[model samples]
Target chain A: GESVGLHLPTLSVQEGDNSIINCAYSNSASDYFIWYKQESGKGPQFIIDIRSNMDKRQGQRVTVLLNKTVKHLSLQIAATQPGDSAVYFCAENTGSWGKLQFGAGTQVVVTP
Target chain B: EPEVTQTPSHQVTQMGQEVILRCVPISNHLYFYWYRQILGQKVEFLVSFYNNEISEKSEIFDDQFSVERPDGSNFTLKIRSTKLEDSAMYFCASTRTGVNYGYTFGSGTRLTVV
Candidate 1:
């Protein structure tokens, strides 16, 4: 699970289109970044991850991008589907053992 | 593909009663953690357990809250006296390694105070 804010930013995309979610991390020393997708009442499901040493990593149809200078991260989903709707969060591991700081999540909606 | 397991998917208790939330992390994992999410708020870290002791905890994990590894396979979070505000979804997570690797989170136990 990840920390959330008072409100979650929502993104709505067409079924066949692509969806891009963004997050700005606070710690400069964070070395590992993970993205999680959470459905309504369940726990977060790991989507993809990228380490500080790499700028980009790709999975089945998802890609993660990291910008060290700006401490920004983004998750890109290609050909979105109905099941793609969920809250997406970006978490950073501070290189301090196992503590993770999570960003406010983005609620994504996919429409057919 | 091992997963974390939590007991009592939903719990309802009196405001002043003591409630214990249980979790069974992946058998081979070395690190365990507890997290909670209020109705409309973000997920928050509560505590992290390792080697039969607490490794880290947040401010929210105050005097009334405690965690234990009473058995080899069970980890529990105990609230000495519950409050209405304590109603939330508590999640348990674990990782095989310390970091760099990802974690597996339990489905969660929804606690409700009556």
Candidate 2:
């Protein structure tokens, strides 16, 4: 079975510092990947995404790096802030299947 | 900006009872989906709908579960007989196109089966 997993379940960083969250996916057929931020009481919000053909994509203060060869993905947040504290999930879309598979999620905390 | 919206933020039902979770996806979006997350677990995909029909679904979406776009704006998921194991947060999402495009997800409905 195909699975997407994170390297860390929780990560803590200081405000103004950079934060990195890593994810590994096992499905080679996955063509698209997305990063979502979820607050305690809200649904997941899309942050950034990358296609298999591209190695990286950047959003406001977020960047997503994809290594198709290693089947790895990472989300980098520049100048982390308290508002950036949330559970982040990486999702992969296997082209063969239309459904998007989500990882268990990584909890990110930013302290001042 | 327009976003997905779900009704009945919370639901509680006894075992063997039926429950329907409703969602209203963004008007311009063409794809609709349902996903669930058990307490402390990963979010799992249940089903995807497009063009008034089901395009894909996961094994978790078994015979007990069914999805329908009964009206122009409403997408509903009905569980024939709820069970304890069915308790989870159900999220509804919509995308302008397919999987290549990111989706907009609703706040989700918490279903509790007692």
Candidate 3:
């Protein structure tokens, strides 16, 4: 079955340090990828998205990298803060459809 | 700042009972969808509605599940007969025209079946 998965279930980072979270998806035909942040008991908040044609996209302090060759995706957070601690999810969209298939969340814990 | 709003933040229902999760999607948004997150699990897509009809749905959206944009702004998901496994957090989301527009999700309605 086609699915997306995270390489790490939890990542610990010191405040002000850079953080990188990785995800690998099985669907090679997917055209768009998005990264989302979900606080406890809250819905997913969109962070940044990258199209397949673009290898990287930046927003605010977040950057999304897509490696189509390996079907891998990564999100980089600069100056990680305690407020940035939340479960992060990566999702893929196919053929201009908004039906998002989400990967298991990666829990990010930042300590000051 | 527009938002998708869901009602009954939490609902406790008995097994075999019917439950309805309601949402008010962002006005002017054309696509509406329902997704569910079981405890400690990834979010799963259920169905997508456009132009008052279902454009797509997942296998998880079986005969027991249905969606409707009964009125102008309200969209709803109904579970005909709830089961224990049906207990999960239901999230409603919507996006304007293009697929580039990622969905904006509502907080969610946590359904507990006993």
Top candidate by TM-score? 3
User: Rank by lDDT, descending?
Assistant: 3, 1, 2
What's model 2's TM-score? Answer: 0.94
How close is chain A of candidate 3 to the true chain A, as a TM-score? Answer: 0.91
Each model's chain A TM-score: 0.93, 0.89, 0.91
lDDT of 3: 0.91
For model 2, residues B1-114, the per-residue Cα lDDT tens digits are 898999899999999999999999999888999999887677899999989988889889999999999989999999999999999999999988786664889999999999
Question: Candidates' interface RMSDs, in order?
Answer: 1.9, 3.8, 3.5
lDDT of 2 at A90: 95
Candidates in order have lDDT scores of: 0.90, 0.89, 0.91
> Which one wins on DockQ?
1
Against the true structure, what is model 2's DockQ? 0.57
Angstrom error of the Cα, residue B29, model 3: value is: 0.2
User: Which structure among the candidates has the greatest lDDT?
Assistant: 3
Q: Comparing to the true complex, what docking class would candidate 1 get? A: medium
lDDT of 1 by residue, B6-45 (tens): 9989999999999999999999888989989887676778
Better model by lDDT, 2 or 3? 3
RMSD of 2: 2.2
Residue range A5-111, candidate 1, lDDT tens digits: 56789999999899999999999988899999999989989999898999999999999999999999999999999999999989898635477777888999999
TM-score of each: 0.95, 0.94, 0.96
In candidate 3, residue A63 scores what lDDT? 94
